[model samples]
Target chain A: MITATPRKDLLLMGIFTLAVLTMPIWLAPIGASYPDLLQRFAIFGIFAIGFNILFGLTGYLSFGHAAFLGVGSYTAVWSFKLLSMSVVPAVIFGVITSGLFAVVIGYISLRRSGIYFSILTLAFAQMSYNLAYSVLTPITNGETGLQLSLNDPRALDSLVGVTPTSGIPPTNFFGIEMSGYSGFYFCAILMIIGFYISMRIFRSPFGMMLRAVKSNSNRMSYTGLNMRPYTLTAFVISGMYAGLAGSLMAVTDPLAGAERMQWTASGEVVLMTILGGVGTLIGPVIGAGVIKYFENIFSAINENVLHGIFDFLPEILQDGAVAVLSLFVGEGWHLTLGMLFMLIVVFLPGGMVEGFTRIYSRIRNKNNKNNGEAGSVGSAEVQPGE
Target chain B: MGILEVRDVNKSFGGLKALNKVELDVEEGSVHAIIGPNGAGKSTFLNCLVGLLIPDSGSVNFNGNSLLGIKPHEINQAGVSRVFQTPEIFSDLSLLDNVVIPTLASRDGAFKLNGWKRADQDSEIIVRAEHMLEDVGLIDKRNMHAGSLSRGDKRRLELAMCLVQNPKLLLLDEPTAGMSRADTNNTIDLLKRIGERGITKVIIEHDMHVVFSLADKVSVMAQGTVIAEGSPEGIKGDPRVQEAYLGGAHL
Candidate 1:
């Protein structure tokens, strides 16, 4: 059997890139808000990709990755306040801070594996959220969260001679306009790059070793391989991806909050990974888009919207149906998400990609059986067993 | 001088003395077989040699380098490769990939940045892995997943993985533990071929047939200490070995 080639992977990636670039345009006829929805999809897709590298390939399920994302956002905001208002420096600082945070947390948390590892990471993330909200009020601005203020001085603003009416500077990509359509495109490009990098890592030898470690750590150790360094490397790389996603988020909105570091947010990415397909390249993206779509679009559907759809039904059935269905949609959308996650885990343990591959293989197996039967009948005169 | 020299190695777990003042000398290019009953510290002894467990007191020297306090991976880097009782091949990886792992690790010293390079493009490493696979008669199943292989094939694959590292000394824990008669014979042949390659091998086995067929010198242990050391015929006639195996009536 021929193995998958890089060229084939590149072709698939090219198709995905084209699809992502044209999605807003394709969905524009439906609503003017499709672009904003697509932008959120791309950002979360980046976040999920990073999370997958840590949990999916390495088999180390981190439940505190959102902490790193929060750190990235805070770092970006700090950079904006202290240094230039340019998104470049802010993003770079954000990524670096996330890596630093990962190094510290990984050193301690990697001491344990399996569920304990997950708990340790979750605890650490909660601790980070607590600190950001309480202890680090000077930096994080406490529960109110950090937002761009008019009183804050931008030292670079005077050098560039761009005097703003309010001290709060608008988001810009190294002097280039990063607002409206361009900002969304910028985030889309970053997500595509992040996806490409993750794909490269998944196909790399280091990725193979990570998979091997996940399959059997004892075996890899006996082969004279120290698993710690490889694991730490995967963790840091994944953290960097999270940092990138967080930096993009800060750039998009120019605000940072402690809520982003919550353990629930970390668990959300895990949910996304499992819902889409954990090990598959594009599964996490699909998972992220689906969840984000539900969060943004589906959650907006209230009892009125439900009634609008069920208007053609009998009046008695419509009123009762809308009331009951309303409980499962909109603000109750998380209930739907939780149910979908459970179903995916129960029926499709390998996630959505495996489900798709299973169908593909079933068809292939059927065709092969048919060919075998035809060949057997054709050779019946020569040899009965053949 | 011996290639591997262990001096006054002692190990204990809780109140149990697993190994007490044990000394071993493995000459270069010689097959050394270690035989013992259950819980006789044979596995513990092997673990100590490979740095899995540090001896309370003693020094293990390989090629004049002290192995004390070295990690297992470092010990492997020092040209000593080990195979566990169970086939320790990376089950999820292809058989060829399993061999390639150690080949790359051995060349680059455990962790390296050569991950991004294509396996086929690493012609030297690929050639070495292929040759080792061919030697173990697993070239045909190189693309098969290690987990799907039969017990015998898995053992052969593990052997191939170790051989690819070009280790100075091979430490095997029950190399033929769960093999059929045909597989046992194939393993013996492979061991003979490996012996001819001039790498010293230390094997822990329960099978007397394997010990008699392949071992140049046998050291039998009882209760964490060497009870008898001699040739196969010498060991067979020894009263101590007979008593260890059969409750002293045969002795």
Candidate 2:
């Protein structure tokens, strides 16, 4: 009975965006030393948001999305090499190239759906990675990966007399530095834009058709709607998002590597999406932050950190605690992630969003019950007979 | 010219003939009913007409356009819409959303890229969908999920979805197969109302009461061949139809 009205959701999203923009200031005490990590968080959050547009809403789980991300990164790096060192052109090239890649992959993969469609995308991604690493070595730089080279002629830079001694010039936007704090802010702006676009798409008629296709494709087809094009559009849009994230990553770091296009990286986005909540708007962003946080912070905790935390315990217990905890941290991080994934899938199939909403509703219902009881008692005292 | 013309359509599944030299001509604004016993290829014929199944030979023409080797969506683009016997609908979407999809798709044509457009802004489509829903008496349940509707109501919702497309030919495969007496009567009345709207209808039904009540022309098929094609009264008294039904009492 609760129909989703976009106005309330949009207002909530606006507040969330405002909070995110001010988060660095709020977390300055704890996160002052980790600006790079925060930047990565925003970039990957953009990636996951784009992934969610296709996988979550349309129910098309694409395994080849990393190819788009890799393509974007490569395109951005090439833009820096050929054009100005500005991140704008690089990111635009990245997004456009990624969209092109998606159109091809989407056209083919969308012919079949479910597991077969997933496998098709996985195959395409693997092929792309292999090509980047070997076959397209001249353009992609192969195993060594594409990097900025000082020796390479940048016609625009030379003509403008803005040539740098370093092979690869640092990324900037209109003479404003794009690295460090500026880089993070740039990525954050892109993330906000990506998030807003996704929010709009989620409320659109096209979004409704995608959901209809997900719920009952046969029915939509019978209703005279061809589902293939809608699905392909979702795929391309998501690919552009992944491309944007990849482009930002390249612009922030000034390098593009074949590793970015790996199948495991593609799998990571899926994990982030599922862990957050498949269809919820903010769920992917939350999931991305959690997984990235674990990757950066949790993996950094070694045996020494474990021992330091348990220093108050007895000597015997302290040493034993560090040993046991080491089984989960550092080299055992994958095991921990695997276990967490399984637990989430088994216990909370709807993911973190559903869990939070459940708790919120329970608390609200309890408060309502208390208020009802209080009102009944007050009314009883007001009765003339009493 | 007939609104829907199926000329010499033939279909076979691995040497087993499902339909052989089947031909049909449905006039515009007429209720054409196809009735047959089990294994008479009634569903197969309907599927062929709607492009769900391709005939080995012959063409299905809708409004003068040949429907040979066309995709199902393309067939729909040609102004041929269908309602499945199972009442196929997007169960997760509301009844109003269910009607809105076909209305949008019909106007935009197949494979359009109108991203992020508001559905409410299309006043023409909204008015048509509202009118169709009103006719089907599903205006009250417009906000309810299509899946939550009763069996009879789901059928009504499916009908509304089909009607909103302004289809030149509405192919209904058993509009009232699993309904109770009251539901069946309601469906019959609904079909009568639809007939009054002046849209051509081609239905494959097993319900004799439904067929007798609404069909302007009834065709009887047995062994994938039309044994009788005439008025409902002619079909009722036809010896071949009686023989086909004699072996299959349910019909």
Candidate 3:
């Protein structure tokens, strides 16, 4: 019982699929054709989408989502180490493991709300981070991360009699190597499935209930809907999404680090969700891409690239221009991101999606005026014709 | 026995007792209004019954089920709905959504997981919610964000949200606290119509006109105690009830 008609949903999904499939071609002109950045975009997009379900809908500001991501990474990396090098087992293992982890964390943290719940989650995440960095070093392999060793017998791979081309076993789907375009495609497909499921949840009864919880937990309870199960369900689902994203990261680059469990990593996804649009379906994904884009491209913009862009100008003027702009890009990309975040928060509290919709409605209104129609742009709140 | 029974309920905040040895028996299918001056603890007593607060020692039974120490949603599932003093509706959601959420909750039980199912396609709840909105006279503004609604409209929307549940007991705290004479009369009319459904109601109101007009049974609370209990006419005529109202009742 999705809110949108099946036809509309299918059409939207088709457009999304086409865009993702042709990313290599479409993104090439922008110099983002590389598989690594693209895979990262898909992976973090999935992460932020899941985070949005819990934060955007339920209003539970979990300060420890990265614990689940770290758990998923460790689980997948462990699967690669112990089981076969096939990503199938790794993904399955990761998602399930993180979901269980979320159940425990959610159950405890949900006992309280507001900043108290946040502190509880932060405590749990900090505990995990500390354990992973120290006592659980054997399991997480400490700061160096759990990496695949060349000497260890991959029992499932050996027993299944699959031979690798190199000494360092490459993760694969049967014989197809999970590297380069193939790996990006695999992650991209998962990202689409993740997006579809997120859209379904957003349109579902559960999603409404979650939003109700956000609006008024006490009211929802008085309405005879226990918000605990709804919040917990949302939390677990989002945790698994984070887990899937982590597993995808492992699928592309086979390593798990303790730093992935840090509160800062959890904060990063929150930033991405808020920066795009908190509750909107596509906002978090777009936000993730924007953040990732800044992290990669903006940081890669060295003095040389700045100089090249200003090469037409005099040499002294080029140097001065590069110095002035350098604060926003290159090693200071985070400063640009922080400024952008502030601007969005102040001017567009609804985030980037709201900005786009606002612009879109303005265009539509102008077109309507051109066509000489009655101006029914009544409410300040944006509601599309639908 | 009454549908909702409260016995020997006592609640204290630090040293101050909000509800002290309070007792109430609300007849089934009747409007029971509890009137009190400021701080008469009418809200506190209601909170105890609705699981918002746990009393030091008391028994609150609704339909033979003990409601004490239970969750608010559990109490709601046990056939009790409450309208807040200031109309606690989902301001972010549309008016239709605000009503449908409760309708779904009432039909689906306290904690059923329906995350994957589409909400708008559920014609049964949607239709019921629509009709409920019409009942409250907010059908035209159904798609509007509830936050944008006027104060009176917000109260009506909240009423629609509660009425859609069709509960055995509807607890209202000052349903007409701050409204025009017309709005107050409209709310009184709405409650009277709801009364025809034979749904038991426990209303805590300060407005004597509303209390006397709607209440089948009236109880006057003062200083955290039920000082007088009788028919509306009898309670109105009581001299001590007049004193309680005029001389700093400290409800």
Candidate 4:
């Protein structure tokens, strides 16, 4: 019902591209312009966008999506170790491997619905995490996780004579080093592409089918529509998005860790999607940015940093303020996050996007009243004509 | 054999036999009505036909093809569409979508990976769905949310959805369970229009006016067993059918 026409589609794409590309400049005011944090914004934004495809569109709340992220990271690291230093192959490997992983898990997990479906996915993720931690240690490298090794046989790199430039090889795009500002740009480009694909999915017929599955699956089945494959396709696509995000992380850092598949990481993406607006196109990415920003700021705020700001107050009051507030900052950032999430859930069930829409509509209504159109046209008011 | 045949169907829940030795033969292009009191197993019988329930020992055949132990979607793909007692249309979707879903399924088979095209932009589906809405006299309400429609309109919208599939056998469970007199007569008129399309229908209803008005044949049931089967006039005059309605007290 909220589908965009082609003209609106292009306009939305243009606005999205402008906003993402100008992040370095716009984010400077918030002290979020550093390359590492900026890259996390793009990477996790992608993760949240993909998660929304299945959870928001189809209402299948998967608690195990991080398994795909873990798989993607491992695949990317392996590609760098065994094939070449180019991120292209690593990203490709990440998407393909994660897709295959999703196909298996989704097939088994989608057999159930509602809480059972969520638990099944969670069980699969936990299994993958445990396997990566211990059982599949040889291939996964166990607790240390996968990392690029210099002595490994990189057949493609050897054929291409792409030896290490310095003491350690940095991932590159056709020999261009993926570091600092350039790395940010590369990830930004990927994030834009990811957002574009998600936007298309939101407007496509397949997207409608997914929504139908969410609306009333029994009716969908009785309507001669089999919704199983539609949900599975959504699951795999979202999984590939998580994989792509994971691959980007490895491309930037060249390290794969088992913790990426942890339930906390999966929960974080769910939080991002729900906090930003579960079913809205831009909500999840915004949620990702907000959560990442708070995590960074809250973690950086030490007692001394708090005291520095509170210095304007009297000495006794400053000490008291820092002491009391310290529980929600620094290592206790999650407490603040928890409180914020609770508030959002209680006050804005439709998430931050709905909050914004309500505010915008209120403003427009006030403006219309000021312009004397309230008396001439009462279109905003619902009439009981029937 | 009729288009839809149910033979020796028996279903039980624990100690209660919900449907006991039920048999039905819905003929081609005929409007057959099943009238029974509450707990008469009319709904259970319909569920068995649509693969929502499996009878302990029975056979359901549609066009000579067995409809047993198959998935719900498979039953739909077998050219059988059911209208729920309570409208089961997608509440969150628009009326156009509610009407067009069956069209999409018919054109695309049971399942498809058609993610590229926009559903609204597809002229073929829109045309067909609009035509169905027109048939149900609901062409103007196409854009409204299905859930927001009135109770009577919800039934009409669901009917349009089922009819859009051009199902070989249309099975309706309590098609008009609660309605005002005007809405009931309006539904009767719509069914009369549908009857002209020559599609076989098996409807379960309690309204005698509706049964006497539309059904070519009527079946009366009580305690999960059919007691009488005949023309509307004959069923209305049957002593056993009267006994079933009056709970074995002579009327």
Candidate 5:
């Protein structure tokens, strides 16, 4: 029921674009401005945004989306090997291949719903992972993973008479190399475009139908609507988003690994979506940034860094504090992530967006009370489902 | 010939018979009421007609086409809309969205890829949805979540959802299942107000007041089959119908 005006969406888009584009400037204080981490933020943000279309809108929890990500990475690497070092062909092939893969898996997996549907997807992903790791070694390159070789036919590069160097060429957009700051910017632009498309979907009739499917599928059928195609379209779209993210991963660092398709990777995106807030347009992206920040920042903290921060304290007390905190950082960062995930799930079921809305409404209410306004109580309340 | 015809429809669940040789003929532009005591196959018959339950042996013809073996949405696309007894609506959506969905379903058929356009920007559908909300006297709450409405209001919203479809036939299962006397009367008045649309309606109800006020014809069912059919007055006084209600101990 929260009506989204064009003005409101435009305003939201403006803020989102500014925030994403200025990551290097603002996130410097938090030490997350490095191009690799920034690129991860944009790429995973796209993944989570797409994942929300199916999981948040349709309420279908897929535990196997990593398969699409894996598929996209492999397809992109293959495109780079056979076609060109330019990322355009790789990204296109990645999205298209994963979309077709989604059509097949979604058609089969969607025959079931709820836990069964999740299990079916998980099974599919695990199967794909195993195949990519061992059975499909010729294409996936098995445990060593897929990477470009110096001798491989770079069709487009050769056709353009672009001589190969001794080292494998880095991926590029036309002639602009995808590395460091340039790579981060490219991924950021694509992420913004993906976010815009997601915003349009959330405001579309098709999106309403997806929500209807989530709200009451029985009533939807009786009201003369089919639930399958709507959900399938959402699933395929989401898979394509994962594919896009995967292709970006390859673009940034021309290597496709089997680990990218692992179940844990799929679970990571789920955690990001839930941690940010499901169904909200910007929540998943925020979640993606938070998780990536934790993975990069928290894991970087070592005993020496802790000792340096606690150097002012007495020797014994400093050692005890460092020892106690060591389990929460470094290799133990997953424990911290797990704790945060549990907290978000238990207390903030609506995620960070709901928390922000609650804080915002409380501030508005206080302002209204100070102004002695009796009306406008409902005006500040925004539904998180939007 | 009636607009809807059900002949010798039989549905059984294992050892229990839910419907047995059920025959119903709903004339065009008529309000046909089926009244029965608990577990009298009223809801089952309605489900059979709408393809929710496939009758084991029977033919359900709507507008001269067989309703057997078709999907529920397909049946709905063929102009058959159903309202559940418990007021099944899109509770997470706004009241306006609750109405708008059905209109979109009717306009676009079962599935459409209209993602390029904004749903709220479609002035035609938005205007029609607002009009429906106004008709149900809930235009002020159009922005409120459907889940937040009171019980009586949810029922009204459900009716608006069905009515917006402009279906050829409307099947209602206990349109007034739980309500105060005042709310029940309001529903009766609302049904009468919409009677001008002349949409054929098959309503299964236990409320006799609702039956007498709206039904052009009444069918009384007992056990798993219809025992008597006539005008509401004729069916009310029929000894066989009375026996079915009270086991012949009185009346």
Candidate 6:
């Protein structure tokens, strides 16, 4: 089995659901309880989970996933501008459009594997980014971004006899506005659904085929299994997940920028996946939260904050400590992230999941020793693959 | 008529001719061995039959149907399985999964979007895979990663992977290349047991002991062409076989 047993999986799901729903309460101590950043954690978590399906299962490193995310954002915004302010239609349109986009890109890119496949995806994404910025100006609204306007005819809203308001109407689900706590909950529920789907895929026969593709694709063909369709299916599924995440971003704040399709955004998702644990179920979510936390909180640590923290030190030592530490915070927070990435890659190639597994197994081993069950310890130790 | 027919099959890589007008026929339910020196094109011929490498000009017919221009998976779906010399098992997977994959493939054809079914809970496929693993004497370690197994064990796992599909033709390239004496004997016994199931086997080997022990017929190749073909005992007495093994007047 690629994942745990049904009972264990259900238990894991329960724990995850509880933790996510109470994120606002628990994350308050870390100053991450605010709605905007909370929404981001859920949104990017969905993005990274989707990316993991293709990259982790099939070992096809895609560098253009952000293009799907951008497509979704644009689609959702267009839905808002053209159809209505309801979030349902925007999510549906966003997902379907991005899935079609994934079909085209995945079909072409999957012809090559390894570095060539990565380069092909990168090229496609870059082309999409440039097109959205320039050539597709009328459709994408160019560099300034796609946003809803009052002058445009919202046909669906008008048919429902929704009176035109002075200011722009907030995106909503029925009467509940998609902003503040409601917006975060909407994204969080979708993220949980996305996670559940990924878990099912991980345990499925198709998942086994995908893992077989990763292990030895050459042998798979001889075993009478074609890997192309499986990879393509995964690509479309993941692209739809990215689209969902993008649509959530629009629902939370109804704007779609061309910058979302940039190569850096694509690279950020890769970092999140690798940093958490490439193939583990919950690793990418953890990775996304960590990276996003760094992006928001860590970068907000300025020289003044550093000085205040070092105020108890002697005058010279205080200045010295702040000077040295400031390089890794504020505008230099990327330095901290880079070092963490390098350390994780070098020491724990399986990412943070491996680190957690080691710690967990070590604790179990120590407990067994304390209980005088040394004879069974070796056999009882859990394997990483299992 | 033979089950598999190959006529005037040829392949070239630059100036080197890997196979030159190779003609062979494999009867149903018989073991055919191709023995040769390092560069005798034995592997190349096997590759052609499985569509890994297309023959430059020839016809490869299996069960009255041509096996040309088809993908490897499609050829495999047509009932041809291959065991590579290097033992191409899915090392990252458990031994059980290594066998179950082929079983699923054999049942589901080349492609099936079977995402909803729980892979580990499939009792029928699991039973078949376990039976194959048991037949190969690896059932005890079925949950272990295939990569963690020894060289001989990996070969056994690969064989189980191929046999689980119940292929009509099994192409093995040096099945006992790096096995110990006992392991080699075990493999020979395993092959003989599998032969009773009526699966046609084409083996490429360098060991004369294995060739004589299992092959119903033997073909000796030298310089990219078959030099002689006959019963194992008759091929042993052939002079061309001697010349191919030992350089003649030039020595």
Candidate order by lDDT, decreasing, is 5, 6, 3, 4, 2, 1
Q: Write the per-residue lDDT of candidate 4 for residues A36-107, one digit (tens) a residue.
A: 999999999999999999999889999999999999999999999999988999999999999999999999
Best first by DockQ, ranked: 5, 6, 3, 4, 1, 2
Question: Which has the greatest DockQ?
Answer: 5
* Candidate 6: segments with Cα more than 4 A from true spot: A1-3, A375-386, B247-251
True contacts kept of each: 0.47, 0.53, 0.72, 0.63, 0.79, 0.74
The TM-score-based order of candidates, best leading, equals: 5, 6, 3, 4, 1, 2
List, for all models, the DockQ compared with the true complex. Answer: 0.42, 0.35, 0.61, 0.51, 0.77, 0.69
Q: List model 1 lDDT by residue over B23-109, tens digit each.
A: 788889989999988998999999998888888998899999998898888888888988889887788777878888888788777
TM-score of chain A of 4: 0.95
The sequence of per-residue lDDT tens digits that candidate 2 reaches over residues A276-339 is 9898788899899888877877788899889899999999999999998898898788778888
Which tens-of-lDDT digit does each residue in A135-193 have in candidate 6? 99999999899988887677799899985668789999997999999999999999999
For candidate 3, report its TM-score.
0.96
lDDT of 6 at A155: 75
Q: Where does the lowest 10-residue lDDT sum fall in candidate 3 chain A?
A: A377-386
Clashing pairs in 1: none
Better of 2 and 6 by DockQ: 6
Flag clash pairs in model 6: none
Q: Where does model 1 sit among the CAPRI classes?
A: acceptable
Supply candidate 1's per-residue lDDT for A372. 79
Any idea what lDDT model 6 has? Answer: 0.91
* Candidates 3 and 6 compared by lDDT, better number: 6
lDDT of 1 by residue, A1-386 (tens): 32546787779799989978887786567453465677777788999998888888878999999999999999988887777678888888888989999998998899899999999999999999999999999999999988887766677766777667754668788677566677788888988888888877776777777877787787676667788888888888888888888887888888899999998899889989988888678889989987887787768889999999999999999999998889889989988878888888999987877677667666666776888753322211111000
lDDT per residue, candidate 5, A20-108, as tens digits?
A: 99999999998999999999999999999999999999999999999999999999999999989999999999999999999999999
Residue A277 lDDT, candidate 2, scale 0-100: 88
> What is the DockQ (computed on Cα atoms) for candidate 3?
0.61
